[model samples]
Target: MQAPINIALVGNPNSGKSSLFNALTGLNQKVSNFPGVTVDKKTGIAHISPSLKANVIDLPGTYSLYPKSADEYVTYEVLINPANADKPDIILIIADASNLKRNLLFCSQIIDLKVPVIIALTMMDLARKKGVEIDLAGLERELGVPVVAINPRRNKGMAELKKNIELVVKEKHAPARDFIDSNVLAPDAIREIKTYFPSRSDYAALHVAVNSEELPFLNDGQKQGIKQALQEHHFNKTKVQAEEIMQRYARIKHIMKASVVETDPLQKQLRSEKIDDLLLHRFWGYAILLVVMFLLFQSIFWLASYPMDWIEGGFGALSGWLSQVLPDNKISDLFINGIIAGLGGIAVFVPQIMILFGLITVLEDTGYMSRISFLTDRLMRQVGLNGKSVMPLISGVACAVPAIMATRTIENRKERLITIMVTPLMSCSARLPIYTVMIALVIPDNRVLGILSLQGLVMMGLYLLGFFMAIFIAAIMKMLVKMKEKSYFIMELPVYRAPRWKNVGTTMVEKAKIFITDAGKVIMVISVILWFLASYGPSSKMDPVHEKYEKLIVEHPDQSEELNKAFQSEKLANSYAGILGHAIEPAIRPLGFDWKIGIALITSFAAREVFVGTMATLYSVGETPEDNDATLRQKMSAATWPDGRPVYDLATGLSLMLFYAFAMQCMSTLAIVKRETKSWKLPAVQFVYMTALAYICSFIAYILFK
Candidate 1:
């Protein structure tokens, strides 16, 4: 039996590290927490050859070894702590070739750590297109380690990369000399720290001296000793770091001079710049942004409809076929009505979600997404946020939990807090099903200009409404919070290129799988519980309904089928779900929702998308109405009040949609908010304020439209 070698993949953000990981691990990766931290740890098996295999751990992307945020801290902790389980046997450093100078600074730092390292130069294609040429062999000789040029996106150089990795792991090839003169710069401090970390490399000991307080592996005694050494030596951490960078870059320039060449010394402007000029124009930029966003929503509707309908019809047919194949019993009912119906509700929306994520990924791959952040900065700054805040806000359209996490990148505490507080106001994908169903019922599909869909226009309008509301709320918060801090926005715009179809496809698939595995579990459990509640009632209420149906069936055998269906509906109205919904019906009636809708509102506090599954269970699964052929949309459209007025009329549908748009209905999002904010106070306040706003807006909507 052979033990698997451990490989650590580390690189800067947007350095093609993840692409390489995906290429190596494919679908074998497992994502979980790293030991005790909430930061994600993604590891998978990479088979180097027939007999050699490696375990690859993708560390969080970091700019340097110094710890700044939780992410960077994790990367540093794993690398420096010898006792840590993830300390790799070998290191693969991904360096962006297009920006070789900045990339090599970190590469040089790692080389001094004396670990077996193989450099993988990514983005070489883009570098070549920009007239940048690198001598791979010269780079290897200069760095004193094996360097392989690879493009993970195109599957280029994989065999060579694998061959190099195998050789490095077997041969134990590491740099023989330090890239920087650490002994001359931090001589006294490094000697002192080495007394404690006796086995550590000189550079590792120096890092311990620089940031002993934040490193978890340091005991109190070691920390006190390191701090004392720093004080006694009069160590200047910043000045030392600056000098180290200069020394590394000085060496890098010598290396680049011999190994690199640029055909165009006068930098040629890329097509990306030309596009940005028009797309970032002061007035037209915003107008163009509005159009792009509108088109995104419109495309979701136009492109996803075919697949959505196919999924819907497939599920409907499956439900019918399963009913015929299995005997009519509680198990059958659970499978068809409870699990299938609830799952179907979620499955139909998968197309829309995938489409949205795919388009967003394409926009990101082509470099347009950064331009959006650049364009929105001015407007965002006016409202107490800067341009960087726009990324999280825009990302909220997918999910608020990660969107809030993204705020960690904003260094300004005030701006970050404001962004976190107002980000949930963006219409996330969880609310998409509710909006889609309601819009289909209330808004006609007729196109306004023969090219624009009215339903899509409504969807776009709802999204814009949320954005405007977020801005307004942030401005108000800025006035009330009394926060004063220096803020700046620094961003790099990547050169425009054709969309990387493989990357886009990978993201689309991953997102779809996440939704099914993550959100589907929540929906399934809630559905089963709701099915029980809606399936039974007190014996006094349920027994009589069954008895009356039996008596009516014998006397009027010809009408027995239709009569029995009606009896079941009557029984369900007396069921526990009905009782609870009716209890709250009076209070919600003012906002235009009835008892059934009230039940959905209660269950949906767990997640916004659960409203669709809840409705499916209560309407279709719980009552197997005579019109079993109809879809959820059809059933809701067919629903009528006691007086024969449609239940899903324009006013009622709009009211419910608006409620979901504004309300803090997702418990998972609230929990994430508490985790990120480190307090229950903000999430508590957020829930109260959002619910109040939802109610008030829904009340007004019902009054005006009904």
Candidate 2:
């Protein structure tokens, strides 16, 4: 079989490129990192024809070929770097019709790359609504490239798009004309670089001359040669870039004037603008944001309760049945107490995780996610960041790894660093399992205003706490980290649209799968280890517990069940896990953590969600055979300290929640942090400061609640 032809999808942010990619690829897509970069590379297989299956690569959305951030650099390298492995055979530029003038800047740049290019025009309805209309033939004639109008959302014009793609690939279509004269910008520099890169167009050579130092494909010798060539020509890259943009826009203005018509020169305000007037109102915007957040957090509990209960009960019955039928041996103990118990703990929270990601997806699909950045810009600026920082912080709620990677978009170095440092402070979904279980254990299930759930209110409060604390830390870091650069918040608010339910559903399912597959592996391994440690101990200590329990059962035959319970508890306390937990108990006791919780604390350094699984496994191992049917929550609620006080009361529960909130407890998070900052020192300092803060805050929470 022949290799699939590579087609790169390129467009500006929110230009409907992703939707088009999804429409073309359907369920064939996969996400991975761009070869050496952390930026997500989304690719898929699209059958353009029965004979032609294309490899569709959705490159990072960039406004111009001039790269600014890491993501933009990836797109630039893939296009301009001669040696890049995934370089496209053709470029599919998705242009937003409603904003054709602004979108043309990027389209024109891509066309000038002298590659096979197709313009998939989208949002024609949105354009017509804005009183702008374009003649498709004229647009194609002006740009000298094939232009296909498409509505990926409604699945319109896709057949024509596929047909055009197949035609272009088979024939090796290339743009007939350059949109702008590249020689006028830096003639000598382009001529000099083109000699070394004989096949490269003048435009491509100009870009290479301008960005030679940063382009990864160029060897040191080539870079030095390019540098010498540029100096010999007396090339001013910045001046040339400014001039080139001016010339392109001037030409674009003429093309728009000729091919486009507006029914009203002074058009009425768009429907989106009218709605934004209300939704983005100074006071109302913030108020609506809070209400939206409150509802989102509340819905996590309200919508997920039924499914969560079903899962919990299902696991309980499974454990009971396994206990009853499985032969009484260590193998059965490992299966029931180790594996099933741990898996059950996490599986029960899948509903909440799915709901959280689904709702977040809804926010993004409707375009309101950007409005949030707009609203938070003023506040973020006060904390030494900008609106761009809000995106990463908000994404942190989903997972810190990608969220931290998202920080690469921030152009300011100091702001980016501070954002990366404090992003983990946001309560990610991994903490959801911990939060939900803790809130259920401690907070009342009653309503606060005769309708709003008090437990949900507490859940919202915990999320708010993390966000606020992150802001506070960013403020402090701003004063300390010294890098002098003027910062600006420049962003275009995308018009709101109805939430794409398909995309939302896909996201929810994708994120849930990631959660289960990634976190489940760790939980299963830890659970088996914990079960062994909790089930067996030094034979000398184990023998004593067995002898004492056997004697007590004989002496008091009526209380044989109680004697067995005591026997299990005694054996567990002297077990390997218990010994490790006891070593840390004295240190954590002031924060209301018992030896078992201390065990969880150590194990869960692997992941915050692992705390729940660790607790489930420990408690399951300590359960008497008669208690096999009890839920993890029930087992935990019935737990007691030596003095018989409930182990997971309001104080301890809140304290544990607060600790997880501030602690750098996730090894994955730390690893990503190191990757992002590219420094072990930053992550080390992050771990130290966060752990200390967790300890101090947990102590205070325990004191106040107790």
Per residue, candidate 1 scores C-alpha lDDT tens digits across 175-273 of 877887787889988888888776447888888877888889889998898888899999998998888878888999999998999888875766666
Among residues 3 or more apart in sequence or in different chains, the pairs in candidate 2 whose N, CA or C atoms overlap within 3 Å are: none
Candidate 2: lDDT of 48? 87
TM-score of each: 0.93, 0.98
- TM-score of model 2 (CA atoms): 0.98
Candidate 2 Cα deviation (angstroms), residue 184:
3.0
The C-alpha stretches of model 2 lying farther than 4 A from their native spots are: none
Q: Report the lDDT of model 2 for residue 131.
A: 92
For model 2, state the Cα shift of residue 515 in Å.
1.8
Best by TM-score: 2
Model 2, CA-based lDDT: 0.91
